[model samples]
Target: MSKPVVLTIAGSDSGGGAGIQADLKTFNSTGSFGTSVITCLTAQNPDGVTGILEVDAGFLEKQMRAVFSYFPVKAVKTGMLFSESLIRTVSRILKEYRAKGQDFHLVVDPVMVATSGAKLLQDEAISSLIQELLPMAGIVTPNLDEAKILGSGEIQTSQEMKPEAISLSKKLGVPVLLKGGHLKHSAEALDILSFPNGESLSYSKPFVQDFNPHGTGCTYSSAIASYLGQGESISSAVGKARDFLHSAIVQSFPAGKSKTLNHNPD
Candidate 1:
């Protein structure tokens, strides 16, 4: 049997700890063939993002088209689309691909903020993402801060997360994987997966006491998409992905002077 092919459309992390690098590592670790289309390149380390250079929208579209034309992409995951034009281009590609009857799984990790407190997406791009890409997503993953931004400051607590997830799913007409990583709790990391079919799943893991777990959200969502490409159901894929991320965080290593890189399994 052939391994599944997974593609990540995101930013490049110069530190090799997050964004496109992390997504590819997670995908390969999960036994999938990983590919990438970089939206932006960041000169960043664990401490902070020093600079970012975004690729032109035309070039981004060309890259996406080239990948789709050549590879049998089983699943596609998106992260750190930094501009409104990039978001729209991605949405257009997805819409066109769907029109061709391609059932490519899409995992959207709405990466609006970085672990070092840097804003990864433009403020105007947030509206574009919600309006354009959300409806086409198979699963939209947003951490607490991203959720609050998406919800317009409505979600604060874990209890509030469920309703917001449901609302977002309904409004966008897609499933949502609302991550609980930013919540100031020690017990468990709870992530809510709400589907349009009126079904919901809550995945929770014992919180690892790692303060420098960078790229966790990217890893989890990309892993889920990889598992989905490997023929797992959504719930099963999410469960396995969560397990993988927990283990990775449990065995994390300090990468830079400040943050750590969660280990992808050997």
Candidate 2:
């Protein structure tokens, strides 16, 4: 039961599908201890999100301080920080830790939209994430739509992914995982990993037909964070994480009416 402690600073999903739920489940599957600091709470099901309640920024930092006081987190990830204020607060805490020489990595999932097409991150949150969060992120995982918002506009095909991945990585000075799950009519789901050092890699898995899953982005980024937390290199972490996520998605099943990834025992 001895595993490296990893932290997820994200929103609570009442649906138990994405955000903190998906992240903690991935940590457990990938052999890491998971701790969480909830930034907000969402009333959502597999079908959609109905409501949201954000935590106070001061209390959010309090949760972070409490976690840091006990466990030396090796890697951390952020999901669904719905406000610029929330984004700034989290970055400030991480900056403080880095100043004191606490070694850790950050995985930022720019969660802009839900599986059901609802806007999760407010419009004002984008600049905050770019200015305050992305610079500190060890890697940022953005789906096709998010990639468009981040820099490359309207990336509708697999061809546009690599350049955007590289460009965004160079622009942010951090590794970027540009996920190609939403590209229509693609035979295989392609994901491009662009490193800040001008290197890149691509991983592809056969698209799971009929499995339009929820929590996939959350689960994938969490797996990478978990592997990195366990001292795996970025390349190894993402490669292994990609494999793990493929299997999880392949094993997906229905939760009531909506499809969801079966990350348990992954």
Cα lDDT tens digits for candidate 1, 1-266: 68889999999999888899999999989999998999999998777899999999999999998888888889999999999999999999878987887778999999998988999999999899988888777888888788778772466567877777777677668888888877785477888898876678898888778457677888898999999999898889999999999888877775556446565654
TM-score of each: 0.94, 0.97
lDDT of each: 0.86, 0.90
Off by over 4 Å in 1: none
Clashing pairs in 2: none
Worst 10 residues of 1 by lDDT: 257-266
Best candidate according to lDDT = 2
- The positional error of residue 162 in candidate 1, measured at the CA in angstroms, is 2.5
- Global local distance difference test of model 1: 0.86
lDDT of 2 by residue, 2-34 (tens): 789999999999989899999999999889999
> How much is 156 displaced in model 1, in angstroms?
4.1
User: Could you give the C-alpha RMSD of every candidate to the true structure, in order shown?
Assistant: 1.7, 1.2
